[model samples]
Target: MAHVTFGGKPVTLLGNEVKVGDKAPNFTVLDNALNEKTLDDFKGVRIIASVPSLDTGVCDAETRRFNEEAARLDGVSVLTVSVDLPFAQKRWCGAAGLENAITLSDHRDLSFGKAYGVVIEGLRLLARAVFVVDSNNNVTYVEYVKEVTEHPNYEAALEAAKRAK
Candidate 1:
């Protein structure tokens, strides 16, 4: 369980909290075209960024930042995940001019949130978090942002991705 706060109020998380050294769990998410994507689909270093919803301001900015960083991270795959529908994710990506990072949807079943322990129990949203996966499928770093409405540590997450790569 993750102790998280949404809008300053403590909220419950409904899944197991993973940490560094744990094998990254394999879960399915929908891509922009509604295709199923799993951890196995992306090879090499992986940065899995979780957000509550992409429609929000914080999430939009965070994802765009990651998209900008992704271009610089050659050979690394960056995934921005949210509970928003795939259609909405596609629209957001297009509107934001995001091309480097992939936007995935966990709205179907919240599989990614549950597998990554980011599921917000009450709101049915995902808590902000970031996970770095090495080529060997091992989790090298994990950050569960304490505040849901705030931005995550972008520098730290990028550093971990670089190290893992």
Candidate 2:
């Protein structure tokens, strides 16, 4: 498992830690409309970004950055997963005017968080991380941010997505 921290304090993460070259784990998350979504639903290259909550500052900025980048990345689907409720996620997207990236809620069950090894043991939130999965469902890039409050390496993740077939 990757060592991570929240607010500079060490935190334990639960689940099987994902890594580059591993097959992307399947997860069930709720879309804005409360529809269940799974890994198979999204075709082509996928950028799966996990965050604690969409309400927080770091998560907000990260999602927004991905939204902007999604516009230029052809055939790439950017999915942001958080423990925030579907309604709250929808509202945030609306207020933020985010069109390119889709927000999914893992609040019902830590399905996405646990599957992707981003679950914060005691927090009931996901640790900050990003996984770029190619069309074949192979994880091409993985980034587990050491600090939950910081943003990920956008350039590297984006480059991996571009290279994924």
Candidate 3:
């Protein structure tokens, strides 16, 4: 179990924490079109960013930053997973003009949240976390933000992706 705080209040996570050397767990999340997308679907380096909701200020900023990063990175897929509905995700992406970072809806089953160990048990939201996976589906970086509202280390994650073996 992982401990995280939201609004300065304690929150417990439900799954085991993933490490840099661990095999990345496969999870199924819905794309904006309601198509099921799994970890295996993506090839090459991937940055899997988890957030509570896209509507929140912190989540918004984080996703937007990743979107910008995604635009500049080559052979890398940036996926922002949230608990919002598919329609809401599509709207948010369109409104935010996120062309590179894919906003994935994990509302159907929260599979991504649980598998990634970002599930906020009390709020039914995912904790802020960043994971970098290589072409072979091995975790190269894992960051479980201590606070739900805090920003992850984008530079570190990007570096890990670039250094992925």
The numbered model that scores best in TM-score is 2
* Candidate 3 worst ten-residue window by lDDT: 93-102
Instruction: Give one digit per residue, the lDDT tens place, for model 2 in 70-157.
Output: 7788999899999999999999998899844599999988988888888999889999999999999999999999999999999999
How many residue pairs collide in each prediction? 0, 0, 0
Kindly list the per-residue Cα lDDT of model 1 for residues 1-165, writing each as its tens digit.
667899999998877798999999999999999999999999999889999888899999998887788669877888999999999888888788774459899998898988999999878899999999999999999999999999989899889888995
**Which residue pairs clash within candidate 3?**
none
Error of 3 at 95 (Å): 0.4
Can you rank all candidates by TM-score, best first?
2, 1, 3
Report residue 16 deviation for candidate 3 (angstroms): 2.4
The whole-model lDDT of each prediction reads: 0.89, 0.92, 0.88
Please write out the lDDT profile of model 3 over residues 1-165, one tens digit for every residue.
656798899988977789889999999999989999999888999989999999999999989887787667788888999899989998998888874458898888989988888888878889999999999999999999988898999899888877875
Report the lDDT of model 1 for residue 85: 90
Which pairs of residues collide in model 2?
A: none
Ranking according to lDDT, highest score first: 2, 1, 3
TM-score per candidate: 0.96, 0.97, 0.95
**Candidate of highest lDDT:** 2
